[model samples]
Target: MNRHHHKPRLVNLLDDFAFGGVSRGLGIFSSQIVADAADCSVVAVRPDALIAPRLDADIIVVHFPPNWRRIAFLLSLRVRNPQARIMHVEHSYTRAWEALKVEQKGRFRLMLRIALRLVDQVVCVSCGQADWLREVAQLPWHKVDVIYPHAENPGLCTLPLPDFSCERPLVIGAYGRFHEQKGLENLIGAHRAGALPGTELVIGGFGPMEDELRQLAGNSPDIRFAGKIDDVAGFLRGCDLVAVPSRWEAYGQVACEAREAGRPILVAPVDGLPEQVGSAGLVIDFTNPDALARAFATLDNQRLGVMARAARRSAQDCGLDRQREWARLIRRLVPRQARPIGVPVTA
Candidate 1:
């Protein structure tokens, strides 16, 4: 078993703030895989991008401007390290295409298509995302693989479920970037409909909609905007239930994370979120605020406990070990010649 032969040089390309669940999950999984079997590095498109501290130090970090120069930088690096395998952890094809259109010149779209073909594999965070890559970006299905990201190591939390002490205030918490796709407006409407006797809504994150959301929550003592907390697990631990009323989702990583943390999740029956939540959480209609309000009203401590237990059990199937296995399967699908040669085998 040649140790040096086992190491595959790998590069991951991320566009911006790696704090989101998808980015964080990919970073954790990639770091662990690289630490155990391969040599890996991460490249942030923006120079001053904020990244998770959990990323392995051995995974070299690089930054480049999100212009034509970024592509040029990647090309130069590829030339210098011809053996390296490049994996684009695509968060959003829409953003990628937008970047290509704005930054590059001279058949930029064509160049992007060609550049995508050059890579051994393009791993999409969800099946919807993979489809988007193929349909919108014109990437071939054979080149795309769906690998739903996993939660960070769940062992960090030690808090036992709080004794069903609160009067079950019909509490609901939504976590994600404050964007149009999140359906925060719908959630607010649902909250206003007198969903429960004592309803409280807590939203966590920061975005352009922050001011609008704040204004909407005005004088509503029942609603609180926590504004981008560092410890999501802590918040999850305290919440009775979680809601993800997304209009569209490539993959709802927060739903998966909440489930892993043993919290019942209520998500819009859209995209890959329902698949991720499985039977553990309620998947309701995204368009109907009244339906969402009714769903929240039905949530109780006993029901939450049952759902949480099921969620935790189901989450085991989507953990880091499952991700590692998927990575191995993807690697096996790659051409043997393209893989690192003479690698030592280990379980």
Candidate 2:
């Protein structure tokens, strides 16, 4: 079988699809792209993965365990599928992650550089991260594409602005992996110190830090964990304010989703969170418990409503244009001469 004679395929290779923003982003993008593409597939580079995206039945899934063997498998796939536009979205590394694993910096950089060289392009979710890859990882700027993934729940984007009449208790909601990077401890302490008075804190999602976070919350009846939420819209609608106190974020998808849900967000000023939030939401120093608490305690319903409107507008500004741009870039990677005519769904 001549690979060159076959239809061009867009393949997204991921190491894992653990419950995180990256996986969610990848799944959303994959779902959208498959409609505009001749054929689309996803490969999980980890063996016996707990969960993965429910892609089209016709899409091929190549599963392989992690390490050197996975690299060899990818290399072989590249050789066989010569016309396929293989793009590896780098979801595993960021400046914060590098800082955490400083010991493996040199080896990891070498590995990343080598692995990326095999693919048609490398996609980074944020511009800041794309810059990091070009500067620190020594990848050519041409090969690194910054395609911001839409974080909105498609079902919720059509909903109206949440009612911020201040009728109920000032509900402050935070969701995501309960990890150190999420700054859940600082949030918990702020709540415990009586900084966020007249408010009830709801923490949702699960992670390795679940036990530690529970311990941090202690017997505070004011703080509650909703665990993994399947109904994202219902969760965001219930909150008066959505807080994303990430110590570091490649791109804070939660903030984007909150905005689309018409809920104002309180976010940390780091990486892509600031870029995504823009002037639509409040920027807080998540490390300073006093400042965080004060910001929450003092915010009025009128101001909250204003921020919510701004957030929804911002989300509208950043939405489908990205999907169209991504389709254009993917088309460039696999020339029109190779792939069949498919509708650019964003149009």
lDDT of each: 0.62, 0.69
What lDDT tens digits, residue by residue, belong to model 1 across residues 35-131? Answer: 4555556645444333222222212223222234455555554454444444555655443234333454336556556656545557676775676
TM-score of 1: 0.73
Model 1 bad stretches (over 4 Å): 1-6, 15-18, 29-34, 44-82, 94-115, 137-140, 151-166, 297-302, 326-347
- Against the true structure, whose TM-score is highest? 2
Q: Taking the tens digit of each residue's C-alpha lDDT, what string does model 2 give over 1-347? A: 33243334544556657655655655544546534743556656445333333332222223222234445655665665544455666654677657664586787777666666766667787887777777766888788888777654656676677677847777889998877888888788878888778879999999899999999899988999999988888887778778888777878788888888777888887666777766567788877878877777667878778888888888875666776776677557655543224422110
RMSD of each: 6.7, 6.0
**Pairs clashing within candidate 2:** none
Query: Could you tell me the lDDT of residue 155 within candidate 1?
Result: 44
Candidate 2, lDDT over the whole model: 0.69
- Whose lDDT is greatest here? 2
Question: Where does the lowest 10-residue lDDT sum fall in candidate 2?
Answer: 57-66
TM-score of each: 0.73, 0.80
